[model samples]
Target chain A: MSRLTSVAGSTRAIRATHKTLSSPWATAGAIVIAALWTLPTFGLFLSSFRPAEDITTSGWWTFFAHPRVTLDNYAATLTATSGITVPQALINSLTITIPGALIPITVALLAAYALAWIDFPGRHLLFVAIFAMQIVPLQMLLVPLLRLYTGGLTVGGVAIFPGFAANSMSDGFAQVWLTHTMSALPLAIFMLHNSLSAIPTEIMEAARIDGAGHGRILRSIALPLAMPTVASYAIFQFLWVWNDLLVSTIFTTGKNAPVTKILADLAGMYGQQWHLLTAGTFLAIIVPLIVFFALQRFFVRGLLAGSTKG
Target chain B: MQAFFSWLASLPNIVQVPLVIAAFLVVVAVIIVLIEVAPRPGTAYTWVRAAIAIGFPVIALAVFGLEAGAAWVFGLGAVLGGGLFWLDARSTKGRGRLIQLALFVSPALLLLIVGLVYPTIKTIVAAFMDKTGNQFIGLDNFVWVFSAGGNGGLISLINTVVWVVVAPVAATGVGLIYALWVDRSRAEKLLKVLVFMPMSISLVGGSIIWKFFYDYRQGNQIGLLNQIVAWFGGEPVNWLQHYPLNMFLLIVILVWSQTGFAMVILSAAIKGVPVELVEAAQIDGASSARRFRHIIIPSIRPTIIVVWVTISITSLKVYDVIAVITAGQNSTSVLGYEMVRQFSLMPPQSGHSAALALLIFILVIPFIAYNARTLKRGN
Candidate 1:
C-alpha cells in the first residue's frame, strides 16, 4: 500500500518536474543503470534458492533454464550446529540493537534539549565539543576499549575498568550495546539539537510561564514538536546498529554475535561456501531492507540532517 | 548487587514480566515525587534534594541491583537536578545554569569521553610506544608505517590513495549521472531504490553477492565474468587475484554501495534546480546537454562536492569489503583493513595499528574541514 502511494506520488511529482527527464535517452539510461545496479543482488537471490550442488556448477542466469529450487540452504544455515546459529544470531542482533538504538537516542534527546532550550553555562562549548567528536576514527577507540574490556586499564598499577567480562558482562552482548550507544551519541545529539534548536523559543518560554519546569516542558512541548526529528534519528540509529560489523565483531563472539558478525564470520571464515553464504546473506539483510523500505522518508531525512552547512 | 543481578537474570519470562512492571511503577512514582514535591532552592528542602541526588544513585548502584541502578542512573540527574534548581533558584551563586545543563548532558558527555576521547588520547600515546605500549619508543611506529618493509604499511597506504582518488570520482560520477537521468522520470522511485537497496545491505553481504560474479572455475566457468570471458573466446581469470585490476574490482564494490548515497543527495539538489532555468535554456534553443552543463550542473555543484567528499571519506575507511573479499591478499589492502589486520595479530602490532589509525584520522581532517566550510556557505 505504501509502495503504491509512493509510486503515485512520484508520478505526480514527475509531472510537476521538467519533462526533459522523461526523454527517451534519459529513460533508457535509467533502465540500463538500474539493471546493472540490481543484477548482482538478483543473481545472488536466485542462486540462494537453487540446490547446493547447482550453485557450484552454474551461474544464476542458467537457473532460469534449469528451474530447480530448494529451501535447504536456508534451513542448513539457520540450523548450524556449532558457532552461532542464524536464529540465535538474529536474537543477538535484537538484544544489542534495541538497547543500543534506544539508549543513545534517549540520552541524546535530553542533552540536545538542554543544549537547545536551556540558557546554561558552557552550553556553547559543550555543543561544539560534542559535535567535533564525531570525526574520531573508530579504530583509535577499538584497541584501548578492547584492552580495557578484557585486560582492564591500569594507571600506576590500579585497574579502573575491572575487565568487566571477568565478572558480569560475560555474555559480551553488553559491550556491543555500550559501544554502539556511545558511538552513536554524537550524531544523535547533533542531529536532535539541530531539530530542537529550529523550534521557536516562544513555545518553550510560554510553557515556562505556565509554571512548567524543564521536565514538564520537555515532556509536553519539546518532545511532541521534535517527534519527526526523533523518528528520523531513531531510524538512523537503528540502521547504524543493524548494519554495523566492526563494533559487533570487536565486542562479540560465540552465541553473542549479531547478524552481521555471524554473516561476516561465515563469509570470512568459511570463505568459499556459497550456498550457506548466499542464504545467510539474505537472511541477514532482510530486517535492514524492511526497515529501509518502511521508514524510507525518515532515513533520508536523518542522513541529510544537519548535513547542509551553516 | 551480584546476587541481585543473578536473580534478575535468572527470573523466567513468566515471573520477570510482573516484576518489571512493579519496578516500573516504583520508578515512575519516585520520578513524580521528585518533580511534584521537591522544594525550591535556598529553602528548607535543600538538604533533602542533595541527599536524594547524591545518596539515591549510590544506593541504586551499590545496594539495590543492576536493574535498579540502570533506572536510578537515569533519574540521578533529574532528582539531584531538582535539588540544585531549588537551592539556586535565584541564580545568586550563578551556578544553577551550569548544574542544570551538566545534569542533563552528563550521560552523553561521559560516554563520549570514555568511548571516544580518552581512547583517542590513549591511541595517540600508544602510537609513540612500542608493541607492548609500556615503553616510549617515539617516531619508530610512524617511521615503520611509511617504511616499505614494515608490515606492508606503505603498500596499504598507496592502495588507499588509489581508492580515494578512483572510488569517489567513479561513484560520484555514476550517482550524478543516475540522478540526472532518473530525475522526474516515471521510474525514478523504483530506479533510485534499485540503486539504493545495495546500500542497506552490509558491505560483507555486498562482497559475497559480488564474489559470485568474480567466482572462477577451471573447467566450465561458473562465475558471470568468467562465463562472459569464456563465451567471448578468452580464458576465465581469477578476478581478484589480478594486481591493478583487483584493486578496481574491490573499488567497484565501494562504488556500488556508495552510488545510491550520491544519487539521493544529487537528485535532491537536481530537483531544486528552478524549472524556469531549464525552460529558459530550452526556449533559447539550447540542447539538453548544454542546458545540463549551463544550468543543472552548476546548480548542484554543492551537492556534487558533498557527495564526492562523502565518498572520499568512505574510501579512506574502506575496510569491510576488502576484508570480506580479499582479506588484504594480492596487495589489495587499504589503511583501514591493514590497521585491523595489524591489530588482530597474536601479540598485536600496537604501534603500527595506532599509527595507521591516526593516519586515517589525519587524512580525514582536511576533507571534513572542507565539507564543514562548504556546507556553511550552502546554508
Candidate 2:
C-alpha cells in the first residue's frame, strides 16, 4: 500500500513540475531557439541536394518555389580530376581515426588502471601532473613537435634521436597516429581513472583475497564493469579525430590529407563551386552524424563523466 | 617480409584498413598477454619472457629493414626490454607491485614525456631564441607581440581577448536559457537534438554551412542573410570583408557550434538539481521565474562555471572557424591562427610563433586553475 502511494505521489510531483515548466511562453521560446539553431545546417543540407545551377542562383529556402534535386554534385566531387577527391580523403580519415582512437584508449586504459588500483609511490603526484597537462594548448606543442618530427632531437651538437622521415604514405600515417595518441593521453587517462576508481573497493578486495592478480582482476572484473565508459570514450575520440582539421593539415601533405582538410581546402579555393562544396561538406559530416545519433546516449554520458565528475 | 609488407600496402583501402587495424590490435594484444603472463611463478615462464624480450627487438629490426636509425631502435628496445625483464625477475611476492606499475604506466609516460613535456620545454626555449631558433635574443618576440604597428600582434591579442570574453558568455547564456525553456517539455529529445546537432559536424563543415549563409553575390542574393536584407530593400553587404563585423561574424560560427556543448552540459546539470527543493519553492508561491532565479541557478552554478571555463579555453584556441571563413584576413586573426601563420611564413618566424604559443598557454592557465577550484568545491 505504501509502495503504491509512493508511486502515485511521485507521478503527481512529476505532473505538477511539468505543468509549471511547460508554459506557452517557454514552449514558444524553445521552438524559436531550436529553429534558430537548426536552420543554417538544414538550409545547407537542402542545398546539397539541389541542382548546382539552382543552388548557385537562389537561396535554399526558395526550394519551395522550384524544387529540383540531383546526385551529380556528389558524383562530381567524388570523381573530380583536378585535386584530392572526396573518396580518397574519406579513406584517409578512416585510417587516421581508427588507430587514433584505439592506440590512445589502450595506452590510457593501462595507465588509468595503474593509477587507480595500484598502490604506488608518487601516484597522486603523477595523476595531478597528467591532469594539469590537459591545459597545455596544442599550439604550444605543435611547432616543436613538428620540428622534432622533421628535424629530430639534438642537444650540444649531438643527435639524441633521429626524426621520422615521412617518405611514404604509411610513414605519414604513422606520424599522425602517434601525434594523436600523444595529445589524447592526458584527458583519456583522467576520464578513465575517474570511472575505474569509482568501482567499489569490496569487489577488488574480494578478488584479491581469491588469489587474483591485478591483471586478472582488471581483465575479468574491472574491464567488464568499465566497458560502457570505454565505449563512450571511444566514440568521443572517434568523432574528434574524424572531424579534426588542424592536426591533419599540419601532419599530412597533398593526397594524404583527411576529409576535413580537403573540405576546408575546397571551400577556400573553389568558393564558387557551391554544389561541390555543399556535397563534400555533407559527405564529411555524414559519418559523425550517424555516430552522433546512434551513440548519443553514450556520448553525452562520456561528456558528463569527463567534466562533471566532481 | 618486405614483399609481404609491400603487398599489404598495395591492397585497396577497404582491405588495408582492417588489415592494419588487425595487425595493431594483435601487437597490442600480444604485449598485454605477455605482461599478464610474466608474473607466473615458473622457470619456463621466466625463460619464455627472457627470450621474447630479447627476440622481439631483433624481429622489429628485421621487419623495419636496417636503416640509419636501426641501431638506435635495436639498442634502445633491447636495453628497455632486458632491463624490465631483469627487474621483473628480481621482484618476489610484494615487490612485484612496483614493477607491475612500471610496466603498465611506462608507455603513457614515455609518450607524454616525448610528445608533450619535451616539446613544451623546447617551445619555451624557442620563444627566447631567434627566428631560426639558433641564437638567444631575449624578449624581442614578446616585444613584437605587444608592439603597436603593422605586425598586428596587439590587434590579434585584443581580438583574442574579445573572443574569449564574448563567445563563452553568449553561448552559455543562450544554452542555459534553452535548457530551462525545454526542461521536461514534450518533444524534449527532438528539441535537444536540433540544438545539439551542430556539435557533431566538423568545424570546417559548420564554417561551410555558415559561409553559405553569409555568401554575398552582386545581383540575386544567394545567401540567406542577404536575401533577408534584399527582402527589406537594403543593399546586400559584403559581411566577411568588414572589419569588426567580420570578427563577430566568425565568432557567431564558434557560438553556433559550441552552444550545443554548453546546452548539453548545462542541461544535464539542470536535470541534476534536487526536485524536492524546486517543489518546495513552488509550493511557497514562488513564481516560476523566481524559483528559477533562486533555486535552479544556484544549484547548477558549479556546472555553469565549468561550462563557461571550458568554452573560454576553446575560444582562446579558436582556429578552424576563422581559418575556414576569413583565413585571418581583415584583422580577424587571433593567437591560435597567428601562431600558425607566423610559423608557416616565407622565412618562418619560429620565435614569434613560439612566443604566440606560450602566450596562449599563459592565457589558458587561469581558466584551468579556476575550473579545478570549482571542481574541488563541487566535490
Best by lDDT: 2
Model 1 segments more than 4 A misplaced: A1-17, A153-159, A167-169, B1-42, B56-90, B93-98
Model 1 - which docking category?
Answer: acceptable
* Candidate 1 residue-wise lDDT, A1-310, digit = tens: 2322343455444456556546878879888999988888898899889998898877788887889989999999877633868877877777667767877887788789888887756779988888888788787788888876666555445443345445334454546766887888888898889878878878877887888866677778888988988997888788778888778767876767787878777877776678888898898889989999999987776666545431
Backbone collisions counted per model: 6, 0
Model-by-model DockQ, in order = 0.45, 0.48
> What digit string (tens of lDDT, one per residue) describes model 1 on residues B1-379?
3343336435542353345445534644454355433434564555655555555445544442333224545466456645555565556644334444545666677788888988999999998999999999989998998888876699899999999999999999999889888885777789999998887888878888888888887787668888889889998899889898999998999899999988887777676666667777888998888988989899878878988998898899877888778889998898988998998888899888999999999988899888878877865
* Candidate 2 per-residue C-alpha lDDT over A100-172 given as tens digits, one digit per residue, 9 for 90 to 100: 9999998899899999998766989999999999998888888877877666565455455445553233434
Question: Global lDDT of each model?
Answer: 0.77, 0.83
Instruction: Return the top candidate by DockQ.
Output: 2
Model 2, docking class? acceptable
